[model samples]
Target chain A: MNTTRRSFLKLMGVSAVGLSLGQLGFDLAEAQAYASKLKIEGAKEVGSVCPFCSVCCQIIAYVRNGKLVSTEGDPDFPVNEGALCAKGAALFSMYTNPHRLTKPLYRAPFSDKWVEKDWDWTLNQIARRVKDTRDKDMVLKNEKGQTVNRVDTLFMMGTSHASNEECAVIHQAIRSLGMVQMDHQARV
Target chain B: MPKAFLVDTTRCTACRGCQLACKEWHDLPANATKQRGSHQNPPDLNPNNLKIVRFNERMTKEGVVVWNFFPDQCRHCITPVCVDVADMAVPGAMIKDKKTGAVLATEKSAKLSPADAKAVAEACPYNIPRIDPKTKRITKCDMCFDRVSAGMQPICVKTCPTGTMVFGEREEVLAVAQKRLAFAKERFPKAHLVDMEDVSVIYLLAEEKEHYYEYAGFM
Candidate 1:
């Protein structure tokens, strides 16, 4: 289901109207501090899925000015019912952490230092290396003379961050190259 | 009506979702931690971490190992001693949001002397409230006032997959706590609510408070 920013704000407005303040007999002086607006008040809600594990909890990403500001479990998603585990709860940090890599880093076979590389160069290098490795390691037959189309040395490590469609495409691409050694970060 | 939190520890699995979710909402920095031979990282609550899942392990007399997970945070007491102490030093340093019963440390808290901040922290029965050495701002859980004010659940309660944390009006939350206590009593005879009358954040312990944490209850 799609949730437009206007519709989401309308829903929030209803809940906000139900809340009342300043009846607990305490000094009303702090009311000014409490009146500050919510951080995600006007942010747009974009639905996404958690990439941590098989749970695949749905999350609502709050976007403000085209930038992701916050994230929380989607309340309408029945599977999680707006709940998330520790790994899933840290989804927001995954975007904001300074340690996260923004650009690709490459290192030569014997070089100890990693140099930053652009996406175009990184993609071209990866394609070149894969073709070279597959050409060198492709095996047509086993010792028993059985026909087996496989690349014994070219291994592909899959990531959970890849979507289902991306994974399908990746699987097909690798299989066509006769790459047999495959693993996923989520499972191992 | 004032708000309250009912944390049923019996249902907690120590996933620390609440701890991490709280940090994510506050945008707090990560702490440098080393292997402490346990899952409890960073040792204790610092300015960066206002909430933490405390792990306590003990060997029973019958040679059984008992592990208890206590998700700890500021209790937001009904009559907060921290507020009193903080106010004595700086008038608007610490105040309570009457609508939610959330004890908040204001920016004025930074005006407090280091000694006065320590006194405020010491006054808390739950040993919450941390003093940031850099900003000198006394910090602790504010019950996610920004969210609660918008008629939303606190991030910690909303992220708990175990349904261990329930937030709502005080009376309704107390009823839920009592019902949970009744269910808990069937399996763990010592199960009881922790200082429900004194604090907005209530905990239902399956065993004695000592098995949970040293300051699990005001005692």
Candidate 2:
């Protein structure tokens, strides 16, 4: 009877579709085929710092064949001692998030939408704007006749995420531009 | 000896490091979230979120609003009615690890019918189990069995900056829980440890359990 049923199924071309009793039901074969692979199995660990706060918690970023696979707090770091806050723990997501901007986005005044600009164009546009703004709003001296070579229009916003060296470099650059309204995101 | 955890809610500042670390160690994906006028995001635990910090607010007798945060997860009950229920429906569906007292859902749990899985979920007093629609498997906190077996603490406990959560041998953890309970009671007068005798994970609540979360403890 089994042979006859098999022959009948063969004649009807149902066997071609793998419609046998054991095969007809739910098949985990497809799912299991992709289950053995690990997302970060062979990744290399690169030490870095969490760019969120002053703690500067060290983190280990796992890279697989030049691509970042994951990140976590470094257990060896004494400051955080393998712990991270909400913002620090989200470093992986911050890098791999779909909302992250790959290129610079520029939104002009009174513009409703942002336009993507290349690195060269963005840098040149920024330089042109900074030069024009400083040239237009330069305040070399106050009413009290103090030598305050400051640009009131151009506000330099510093990032809390910057390292000490990076902050120093940024401070020198901004100071060279004679921009006095310097503020850090930590205060905000 | 079995292992246990003592989560002192009083020391928890709602930093949510434990919650994120659990997700990171588990390799769980991010949840789409929106502002709910509260710090608690994604609302509640789903298939991806094994742990969550629940926020609750209440008025004191003096008419002052008191905000409370409860880091909620599986209690790993000693009796574990969910295990019994799951076993009756699908053998080997759920198993309690003898070494760590971790109630874990094995891979064989995929064989459980939806009704049986729902039954097991309902049997849980803490509402810890969540079914994944894509995989048709129920998942929750496993107490990091792989890490624990390798002599490492659970990721959530290791990543807790506030030292609110602690994991150790069952007896040692219970002793710590009792000590903290005594210290807390001296100050709050209403401090209590939730289900300390019945579960592997004991939570020390400063006020009533209701002020922390609805299912903070089993009565």
Q: Native-vs-model 1 lDDT?
A: 0.88
Q: What is the TM-score of chain B alone in each candidate?
A: 0.99, 0.98
Over the stretch A23-89, how does candidate 1's per-residue lDDT look in tens digits? Answer: 5334455555444567787789899999888668999999999999899988888889899999999
Q: Would you list the clashing residue pairs of candidate 2?
A: none
Candidate 1: tens digits of C-alpha lDDT, residues B113-188:
9899999999888899999999999989989887876668899999999999999999999999999999999999
Report per-candidate DockQ.
0.48, 0.14
lDDT of 2 at B70: 89
| Residue range A1-188, candidate 2, lDDT tens digits | 55653245234343223333223222334223212233444467789998778678889888988998777777778888778888887788788789988999989899999999999999998899999999998888999999899898899888866878999999999998889888877787
Q: iRMS of each prediction in angstroms?
A: 3.0, 15.1
